[model samples]
Target: MIEAGKKIILFDGVCNLCNNAINFVIKRDKNDVFRYASLQSEIGKKLIAERNIDISKIDSILLIDPKIAYYHKSTAALQISKQLSGIYPLLSVFLVVPQSLRDWVYDIIAKNRYKWFGKKESCMIPTPELKALFIDQ
Candidate 1:
């Protein structure tokens, strides 16, 4: 389980796009507000099961704000963006759009992510320096 104040990011392990996004977040995580876990990992699975998240319906990015709540799909991405440094937080302005519309777009990209971006044979192994950023690496 995550600590009370920290946020958790659950991502697809083998998806190249997901790994790249993790790297991007790590670079901009100036205050280290996030920790990560692949959806296939033990903690990831336990969290999902506790929340009763149906993978068939929503299997991609998920953000858990420990005691607060969990966010999925475009909301998760935009919420994450709001936590990053630089111009990225501006992306949360898109939240004014309807969630259904935003999720529609997110779904399209998620569905085709593997076909468009490909996948790795296994989950990324965090380097020693980054190991602390991941819970179940």
Candidate 2:
């Protein structure tokens, strides 16, 4: 279960691009507002089922704000950026760009992510110091 005030990020575990993005977020998570789970993990599958998310449609990233709401694709990315340190929050301005346009671009990148960035055979294993920040690892 998610703790109060914590947001959960569910990502493609074997994706290099997704893994790099998570590392970037971890470095800027000054507020410690995030917890992570690989989409391939049991907890990730459970959360997806609980939310009734159709991963067949959107299979990249997801942001779960506990009982409040959940977000996917570009909306999820922008929302996560807004909570990070430095000027990353400014990325939220793209929210007004229209969801259709935003998702079109997201789809292009996601479709090519594996070919462009490659992938690992298995999910990333969090280091000892970072283990507490992850769930279902």
Candidate 3:
């Protein structure tokens, strides 16, 4: 089980847009407030099962804050943006919009992600220095 107080981000492993987003998060997250796992990994599977979240309904970003709350889709993105450095924090303003509208935009991009950005056949192997940010299988 993941430790309480830590925030975990579960993402699509092979999606290019997702990969780039992960890299963007890592670069801007100077405080290191996040850990990551590809949704296809063993750790990811276990976490999803343990949390009792329905996998069929979860294809976008997932933010798991143990013993607190979890968020998905546009909510997850906005929440993460609030923690990032620079003008990214400005994105929090969009939270005022209704969730349905926000998620509609997210879904459009997610549905065409592979076609627009391509995908890898397998998950990314993090560099040695960055490996500690990921949970073990």
Candidate 4:
């Protein structure tokens, strides 16, 4: 697991889109500002319970910044975009568009994700080079 103060991304490991999104963040996060965990893992479950988060209502991305706070769905995506390098950082502008509208779009994509992107039978195995970046359970 990451140190207490570091930011961590909790995601759906079996979802292809979610997996690709994690890779996208990994590539743009030049500062290495984030760590990752699959929402299905023991650590992910423990974090949810500790935070008093209702897993049944949240199936999208979650960004946890320890004592600072956490963000879900569109908010999480925008918060992460702000930390990325290059044009990726520009995506943060979408935050001004009103959360309900943005999340409506996000929800559409999320709801259809498995049918559209396919799923892995098991969790992803990070490559040896990027192994250290993940928080193993």
Candidate 5:
């Protein structure tokens, strides 16, 4: 079941870069504010359909604030950063740049992520200790 106050992060399951980013967030998430699901999961697909997101256009990351809002690409990255512990919140300052420009850079990284970071044979399987942090694992 989805928790009441946690934001949900949907990510590319097989992408090593995305997996690393999620681990980074988990380490810095002092407030326990996020849950995760792979974009290939049933819940992830359901959320995407509910939001009417075009997966062909946004294949990297997504942040869903439940009933409130959803953010994708650089905006989603920045939003997630703001809640993280330490100086990471400052990264949100990049929001001042236009979304198109920010997403352009993000696209470059996303496009090469598989080639640069490699791909998993399948979606990540959270360890028993971290299982609660994931949904539909």
Candidate 6:
């Protein structure tokens, strides 16, 4: 189980886009604010069940703050960006655009993600070097 304090990012395990995004966040996470779990994993499923999240309706990305609560969709993305290093924090300016509009775009991309980015036969297996950053390695 993930300890208190860090954020846990739950993502579609087989998704190429999601995997790449994880790598992106890892590279920029100078403050070490995040951990990860594939949404298909036992731990990820437990988190979803504990939060009463409906997987059929929301299976993209989830940001579980562990201390606070959870966030999804564009809110999760923007919140994660706000904690990153360099110019990423500036992307929070998009928060002023209105959530409905922002999520609409996010939804479109999420809906077509597999088609556009392809998928692995199974969930990604983190390299040995990155294992500590994952919840269920």
lDDT of 6: 0.93
TM-score of 4: 0.95
Candidate 4 worst ten-residue window by lDDT = 1-10
Residues 1-137, model 2: lDDT tens digits: 56678999999999999999999999999999999999999999999999899999878999999768899999999999999999999999999999999999999999999999999999999999999889885
Write one digit per residue (lDDT tens) for candidate 1, span 1-137.
46557899999999999999999999998988999999999999998999988978877899999777799999999999999999999999999999999999999999999999999998999999999889996
Cα lDDT, all candidates: 0.92, 0.95, 0.88, 0.89, 0.95, 0.93
- Candidate maximizing lDDT: 5
TM agreement with the true structure for every prediction: 0.96, 0.97, 0.94, 0.95, 0.98, 0.96
Give the lDDT ranking, best first. 5, 2, 6, 1, 4, 3
Cα RMSDs, all models? 1.0, 0.9, 1.4, 1.1, 0.7, 0.9
| Predicted candidate 5 versus true structure: per-residue lDDT over 96-117, tens digit per residue | 9999999999999999999999
Error of 1 at 58 (Å): 1.3
The better candidate by TM-score, 3 or 5, is 5
Model 2, which residues run further than 4 Å from truth?
Answer: none
Candidate 1's C-alpha lDDT?
0.92
Give the per-residue Cα lDDT of candidate 5 at 7: 98
What TM-score would candidate 6 get against the native? 0.96
lDDT (C-alpha) at residue 105 in model 2: 98
